[model samples]
Target: MPRLPDDFDDDTDGFDPDHPLADQPALAAVARFARMLETIPWFSRVGDRLDADDRAAAEDYLSALGFPGAAVVPVGDWYEAADCAEALDMHSLSWEEEEHLRAVAHETALEITDEEALDVALSHVAHQAASLVGPAAVLSMRVGGLDDEALARAAAGYAVQACHQAALVLAAGLGAEHPFALKFRLYERGRWPVSITGESFNLF
Candidate 1:
């Protein structure tokens, strides 16, 4: 639940915090890319602490090659609602899904008790997993004209993938293991279109 800076969403006259960095084009580009990567759950939660050290190493390496004075600047929390909206658009998610994800992101961001955060996040993951199953079944049926047994396998596979993605995101955000992560890990070594019912089927 990383909160963007207070001024980040204030779009009065298009004031962007990182806009001034344009004066230093190279650093500005690096900063923009770095900040975007930092928005990734695992990186922001667990990997960000090493950013300064990584930068120092990069500078040292550059200086060894006769390049010097590569300054590192603090990018701060620059993620915004617009950024989330755009990401949802890229994923082809509905507006309702976008809003729900945003809420889940914010909830994970709060500095609340660990138990509370884990509880809430896990519940969200459960609901998301359940919601994916029917859509998965429907899509497989429509596109492949699969029978019930094959449809079930396709649906289960879809649910597993969706849950895995959600679990990874929430787990990184919470800095803890998610139930869906465990489920996905167990199935990771298995073939795709895993069986949901007792029937064997080929996805082909």
Candidate 2:
């Protein structure tokens, strides 16, 4: 499984070990405009090496980017609890779903003998594919009502325009096949609703 860095200095190539870059007046102004593109190992050889904090960061960043129901976490032999969600304009996920995803990832570790440990790592990728972006405000099973328009198909992710650009970046990284990617790729197509404060966004 992928482990999240305690610090973000692992790859200084301007790569987001956590989430995608947003149009921030500063990191604060851009708090809810971030986007995270999950990789698919089934399609290629990507989606590994991240931790819970990384997940939290990704979620927080995605929320900042206006993604509904986005959650971030750190991957490890065991996943860690993310602490920067509120500051990033996001909320934390529920322990149940968090535990569930970790367990699912860990169970799949048997096939990864050639590689190091990979349950939490694989979960990060799978969780994204199985996850519902607009379905809750945070970790809730409820749809956050985020529409496809926010995804910006013209950008990175799924939409028609992003297929070759953003999607390719993930394809080459996780080393998964295109079909596998299609399952989890986020769509930024149409319009949607907005979320208010004091809401609990947990995934079932």
Candidate 3:
């Protein structure tokens, strides 16, 4: 039998792996975000051309947040728990202050393009969004009482909408690997607010 790690997500809802899509939100977000990136000409053109220091900083931020490696741990594998973690990797941990700045620039600014010349840039955008899933899931699983699959589906929806809003606002291509639903949800629009049961971060 597999000795599952403590952090491994045992989906309370029992998401089926044969239909991985049933529980995989990050994959969907990546796809959808990638498509969004293709729609913007700016992001496509300026893809992945960051200066060394900036790139290092961005990589470190994500690494510190978490990424896969021998020393690094998997996000939603056999044994992981839902917790706010400080563990991060060296790739993106090179600098901490620039994390948000880098995410915003790669995701929302004129640097994002839809040009074929920036394939690597498009990939980076997807990677960044992908990085968010693990951390987001960790926060969500305990707070929202969800597993990776449910969190993923929710994140996909949220990410797509967020990216869409950002795209319309900035007029740039945002890369993602998984495509998301384009429909509007009443809850998200503030037309269907739910009653809070306790002290929480107010996850939907």
Candidate 4:
């Protein structure tokens, strides 16, 4: 796993208190992910492009982390458990989905020690890494003149790897015993986090 930069926790360098997203935990999480990418050596290579070795390394690393396979739960089951009911309503989930999310949230809260830390780590993986790295990989493949098949492979591999990297980065800061690390292992194996104490909600 890569170590975060020494200045990783220094949020005052260019911070603007009045910025709209400054106070938003979700945005802060995303910003942290970006900074990780910018400062970490592994992500520096990833930013250039994900190649065969990168894919292989990701597979080996995730396997070591016990990434058994895709989670048994459907992708939709990993709904965000936000702090506010109003934020939950924004998803427009069906009654069954809403109930299921709440149930999962309740279960997760019982299982984990620090839901907030887990939420931040999940935000880094699902929101920042999956959303950003996958598309970026696809574009990089295109730019490299790879074909559609290669492009698809690169995108999937890099995205999954990026998620693993995000989790590991958090682990570096929060300690390996933290929920961030444990939940990430569960996430990789498909035991998705259903709830967290925050305004940010994960839909996919």
TM-score of each: 0.28, 0.21, 0.26, 0.33
Off by over 4 Å in 3: 1-114, 153-157, 164-203
Model 2 agreement with the true structure over 1-204: per-residue lDDT tens digits: 111121112233443545532221112111211123232221111123444543443344345334436443222110111112112232434333323433443343233221222223333433443343322212111133223332322112222222222222231232222221222232221111111223432111
Instruction: Output the number of the TM-score-best candidate.
Output: 4
User: For model 3, how does the per-residue alpha-carbon lDDT over 143-165 read when each residue is reduced to its tens digit?
Assistant: 43445665344444444334433
Number of clashes recorded per candidate? 2, 55, 46, 1
Give the lDDT ranking, best first. Answer: 4, 1, 3, 2
- Give the range of the ten consecutive residues with the poorest summed lDDT in model 3: 177-186
User: Local distance difference test, per candidate?
Assistant: 0.34, 0.26, 0.30, 0.38
Answer with 2 or 4, whichever has the higher TM-score: 4
Model 1 is weakest, by summed lDDT over 10 consecutive residues, at 195-204
Candidate 4 lDDT over 57-125, as tens digits, reads 333433333343422221221011112222334344322443443345334433533456555555555
- After superposing candidate 1, which stretches have Cα over 4 Å from the reference? 1-113, 149-154, 157-165, 173-204
Q: Candidate 4: deviation at residue 112, Å?
A: 9.5
Model 2 CA deviation exceeding 4 Å by range? 1-12, 15-116, 125-177, 186-204
Q: Give the CA lDDT, 0 to 100, for residue 65 in model 4.
A: 37
Top candidate when judged by lDDT against the true structure: 4
